[model samples]
Target: MAAVGVGAFALALAATWTSGPLATGIGAAASAVYALVADLLQPSQRVHAPGGALLRTAAGRVPRFGRLDRPELAGVHPADGPGDRRAPPPYVERDAEPSVRRALEDGGFVLIVGESTAGKTRLAYEVARSRFPRHAFVRPMDRSALAPAVAVARRRRRAVLWLDDLENYLGADGVTAPMVDELLGRRPGRVVILATMRSEEFRRYDAREESRLTGSDRDAWRVQRDVLNAAVKIRLERHWSEAEQLRAAAHREDPRIRLALESGDRFGLAEVVAAGPELLTAWQNAWAPGANPRGAAVVAAAVDCRRSGLRRPVSREWLQDLHRPYLAERGGPDLQPEPFAEAMAWACQAAYATSGLLIGNYSQGYTAFDYVLTASDLPPVPDHLWDALLALVEPADAYDMGLVAHQAGRLPRAAAALERARAGGAAEADFLLAIVTGDRGRPRHAARDLLRVVERRRAALGAAHPETLAAVHQWAFFTGESGEARAASAAFVRLVADATAALGAEHTDTLAARHQQAYFAGEAGEVDTAVRELAALLDVRLRRAEADHPQALAVRRSLIWFSSLRGDLAEAERELRLLLTDAERALGPHNPHTLAIRSTQAAFAAQAGRTEEAIAEFTRLVSERSRLLGHDHPHVTHSRLQRVQGLIAVGRGAEARGELTEILEEARRVLEPGHRHLVLARSLLAPPRHEP
Candidate 1:
């Protein structure tokens, strides 16, 4: 269709060059013929052609000038010529406040006010379009044109008059009291007026006049502001952490960029330019240090602020505002300034050398960055500082940070931090040390260390104490994770008994102990007992903790896995749906927990009869996991295997085969050959071939 239209247009132009007046007549006649043919053929009926067919079909339906098509008229009125037709107003997508749309629908005039680029004009157009879809839309060029446009719209009786950037129209006179009174007194009809103004400008209008026109006095405006504030919602946009950002910069194939990211200095585009060759050299270094650009920036800024006589410890808000202009001046867009500032604040707050008197307080606030910042500035050698710093050195804190660093694949740092923390006298320090040692391939030492922590905690705090029992439980779990199943089972049995007695059978702590016991039982070749224990615990959790609670959802997920092991795919799928819905609502749509549930559901769906649905779900899950968790993460690899299985079940065997081959290669690289996930990947590859 597009090709045919282009051909006709070319012919029309050729005819025009040959003869002026007669050519114009020929062009008009040709356009009419084309329009008739389009009407008869019904352009919408053609769908198989690619490229511009859809565009041609849409253009063919637009209102024309006299008998001439829209395109023919456009050719006559060239875009740049004086008095040439302006392009039809851009279609504004209806995607804003529902209340504003409702008011427009009910024939009420609207005055929208917000900061510039706050989507005010776009929102106004959307509301107008939705309310008067079939009517002509007249937008006045300025305020002087508004009254005339409104008069025309009123006469038309089915038109909407919009005055965009209405503040410009109001001028210094401030929406004159008399003019507003006249507008309010105008007779009601099909015509409606919609306008937008800056919030500050709107305030300058006479109160009585504004009230009469907008039907909202100053008190009402305050109420609206309060309501807007109360109902404002925040959405989390995807952002990279400092470590992730460094990894991304490294992957971009620019050595200088990699080095700048790794320097742990305050990094913006300027720093990248400044570091140039040094950055490249650092990237080339075989063992360059991990980047802490955010951290360095925070420290640098804090020092500068203090030196400049700023009273407050460099705050996250202050750092962000300072960095904004710096980044802008360096020709860089504002990107994750908050996190970078937060990282700086944390460094200043956590700096061990900062005076306690200046630090003020150290507490585990909502954000880890805040906690670290508060901890860093503790006073030198004060009793509270000593106590707080001692607490920081405790095994629990060290162990937590160590585990996080380890999971993030910073093994050396995790090991060093854990070792230092253990040395500072954490009762659970040995447990953390054991895990780090195991990660470093010293399994025997790891097991020994874990056992020592359990023994020492039991001896010092007594076997019944929460700390002693927790140590015992974690030691056993880590032992199993490290591949010492027999020893782990023995530890688990003791943990189960002690936890049940001390924490009570239904307590979450005891339930956690039982959960570990179930896992150990499965490893020790007691599958039936494991299933029984897990089922009982799941039932209790469902009844006690709401199904959506994280702990309860976790237990439900376990039940699905156990059911799958027992070849009860139907039951597994039912549980997966419930868990998926609960996780989606509680943890949010794209959260890791929800993604895990979706992955499980995909596997179960394939196992059941919903193969096509399974394939679709798995495909989405694999893509999301790859984007969010990285392709090499265990979860992503697992999801790929599930996807292959889903594809095979849906009879897309060729595609499944290719996916299986990829999964096999990935699994070999990232997992032990004997790993359960690797085995699953292999199983998916064994399916027979068939067409999609």
Candidate 2:
């Protein structure tokens, strides 16, 4: 049928050479016939394999059970018989096996979270094979492979989406909440999304108080959180239970299991069998004086590269360039390091019938072993390495590194990495760079950069595209932040109308614009109007979201603030007290929203003629904020300024002056010269001298 359709298409094209109406009609009819046949003969994207065995995926070829890498495993290979070379180790059922099997059968998102060498992947593999023997597998290689693999899996009557190291698929171009929702929304028990993540990475993504995240980081974290919430999480402890140990003892006929049982007192049976401690011991011994010192340096460099946010492999040249610093720090000339080529060889040499400290060849680049990476409790990536990595890493990697730096509060390093990413043609780098610039106190600069982003996104994604609209939203926000509140308010009004028209009034983007419109209107001094609109918006938000939802809380806070502006101080205070209680209960007292409410309550007390009390509260809050969020955090700076004002009000000019000086220095170190906090601090430090 497909061949016939192709022939008909060819005939139709040939018929177009004739100019008569009859010929034209015949060509059109034939073209339509070919289209019909072509549609009928379209090839399926579904996986094709015999029942009872998983095979290929849309992402790529699937590795069989024995071929799968079991991290840190060392010892005799467990085979079916004396001569069988490709069989896996004897199966020891875990305590979570029944639950995991049930999750697979029930089908949604199943995640196994554990530390390295905890047998997470092995457990998942065993359960999936036994429970869903006929289900096809789709294993994405990276974020880029995820969507296509999912689409391909959806075509199958039953399939499994296998994601290992879940963090790799979580970010801007990665697995998102909407994607997971779409997959689960389809035939409920047909496709099971199976994933594994290290415990540390899971906690980072699972952080509840994400108020420290800004801009794109906040958006990405929200997506990750939503996906995590939807998953049936199963925690796998590194230590084996008594029942598990007994099960391993049953498999004692397998020498590997016997050896593991003997040494498994400290680590789990799986860990000992996988040679986890042996690998760690080997790596440490390599760093001894006159040992594989250069090779150890190479391993250290690779580990630090990963720690610094370089996920992909690094070239031999890159490692050679990085290892020198590690050598220098480890008594460079005194140690008399081996030659570079010899070091590379030693690092890649396999030990304990398992992987080396570093893996990969000279031509293909290298990456550190997972065991080494997880075990090393290294300090921060050196300044020199940050610069070198930013210079050497690919644009996409550089962008991710910038995000990591930004989240860690390393503003200057983030700017440098994002700048490099932008230069290397990573488009979203501009958006993140603008945010970092704003955080550094250059809102004007951020606004200009956002304008560029807006133009680029509009050209590429169209004016009404959600991403373009987001760029426009940020541009308007920074414009207002740069002291053009009226212009920003006008922009938000236009955005609200456009978003409502394009995406409907209740769409998240539209509501976001409306929220911004109301707040900026208040900033522009239309207090009564802001208050009225915010109240209406809050009602809509409460209906659509939980009362404790961040958006709803924000709207409520804005409405209360504007109501205070309308000379309703008592009502504002009452509302704030209620809000403070709710925020503390729902988001914890240390949450940013809760702290902001506390700050507002303190300010309101001062406004209501309790300056001394307000000053004392501000002082206490400043210390708490500094302790929890670091001293250079913007929240702490704002609180300090408020405290200085309170001190000046109480005739403590001497103390106020000293505090103001410190604030000025901190602002200079972390903020832009034009930042409002920096400008205010300078004014307080050098008040105008009056001429009598």
Candidate 3:
């Protein structure tokens, strides 16, 4: 009985041990079953990978499975080597062409030139393989490595030496006369040299050499045409013939080709042909049955158009017209649903790639195209796919859209997009939301949200990140604008210090911080300190950013106002006139900032006994302001008060009194009685009793 009990316990222990793995296996099997069910449930939304099998097969064929066997060549082809048993270079198939073969075999030196991405590097590889089948094709390891490469070539009795992207290592900085001399002086029998370079790179090399190809001037090609003239030069132009296009289309299995051919819209056929065979092949393969070919054709068309110099963000009407016939041809107005969807997707991608030319910061004006590209492929989407969509969307508009929705009290949509952006780890989204939450009239609850965004951004993007720094500056500016002077001052001080350190003391960001610091310092009751800071910042900006630059002009205007506050009217007028002229030139007439600066100058002139000049300036300013910003605007009221002061300065007491009364009435109507401008107008009227 004891033996049987012990056996039972052992059997139970064995079952327990096996149960964990069995449960894992069952869980994995269940997951697979669910995946299949999910896939079947959504046949319309599936992603297929075609080259995956081929890539896996190629990966397996690699000798070491994952790592390259030779350390010197790393994981690239063995022919791309410098340190192994100097084996012969790999032969390129293009060598089968007699002219190219003869050039590689007999030419003293060869200069391979082509545009970027024009197969120049591949051609160089082929040349190395054919010329030195038994010798290892060693490439220059670095700018310093060129010498060692030359030495190795000398040691090997017969070798084919290739310099891939040689222009990068042989331009002005990369080349020295001594290096070239050494390379050229080496025996021709032991070393057959070849180098690949772009057209622009060749120009730079020619410039350095002062007009000659130093070592082997006998074998140089100015243009791709020059290569064609050579016994070995092979020019690979874009495939344009119908046969070539058809072959490419067949390779890609793109159904659109048939549709396009059937549609008979031939206006841009030449442009389409110039996109090259490889692109056509890619589209065909991507669009074949079972392949989603989402935006392949659209992207291909856009790329083709751009190469032909037609700016991107092609009209939707143009794309529709181009693809309509193709669609009609495929199924006579009943094309397969999947293929139709794929064609639209391709067009959207093309539209995005060509839109606005990737300008600085924002993509200027392709809103329609970006919208279509972003809204596709949702639900169980890959992270990279989501990121690619976002990258194509303009950030400023995305921010503005979120803000507009938030301001209109459309919280759900705003929150949804913001949450999506946040989940996707976008720093700009957090910064923009922080701005929205901190704005006046927002609920007190929003402050916590703003702070949360601020904290998250600081953590993710770092304290000195440009966007993070801008957000912090905005927070401080908003605090000051909203009447929290102390908090604003503290925030400004920290921001100024950080910006000064990170951007360098003289950087534009540092100067902007200093300008804000000056403003906030005055607001916080440090007027004298503010004046000193503004003066220094203005001087630095004038010298560095140029006096006419917006930042420098702004700083100068600030200095003028600070000077007026300190009772320095003469200095204020001097600074004001200089800023006004520059502002007029830079910002144009009727700009609010320019008008404000002019008004400040008028006040300074009135204080300095230049009444006539002040009255003329003020009258013009008041008229413009009344026309531009209504008669009741604060700036208009301010201009009226300046005119009254100018009249008083010239002893026109009656006119001054009348002007002051008008200014007071306007101020009373547009501003509070105790407001600074109203008080100033009342005081100016009190001083005058003399008639004109």
Candidate 1 residue pairs in backbone clash: 264-292, 264-293, 298-344, 349-373, 350-373, 350-376, 351-376, 356-378, 356-379, 395-426
What tens digits encode model 3's per-residue C-alpha lDDT throughout 490-571? 7878988898778788865566777878877887778888889988887786677467665666677776787678786777
| Backbone clashes, candidate 3 | 19
Candidate 2 whole-model C-alpha lDDT, 0 to 1: 0.72
- In model 1, state the lDDT of residue 97: 52
What is candidate 1's lDDT per residue for 344-401, written digit by digit as tens? 3334331221111112111101111111122233322222222222233334344444
Error of 3 at 353 (Å): 22
Task: Order the numbered candidates by lDDT, best leading.
Answer: 2, 1, 3
Best by TM-score: 2
**Which of the predicted structures, 1 or 3, would earn the higher lDDT when compared with the native?**
1
The models' CA-based lDDT, in order, is 0.47, 0.72, 0.47
Q: Give the clashing residue pairs of candidate 2, or none.
A: 72-274, 73-274, 74-274
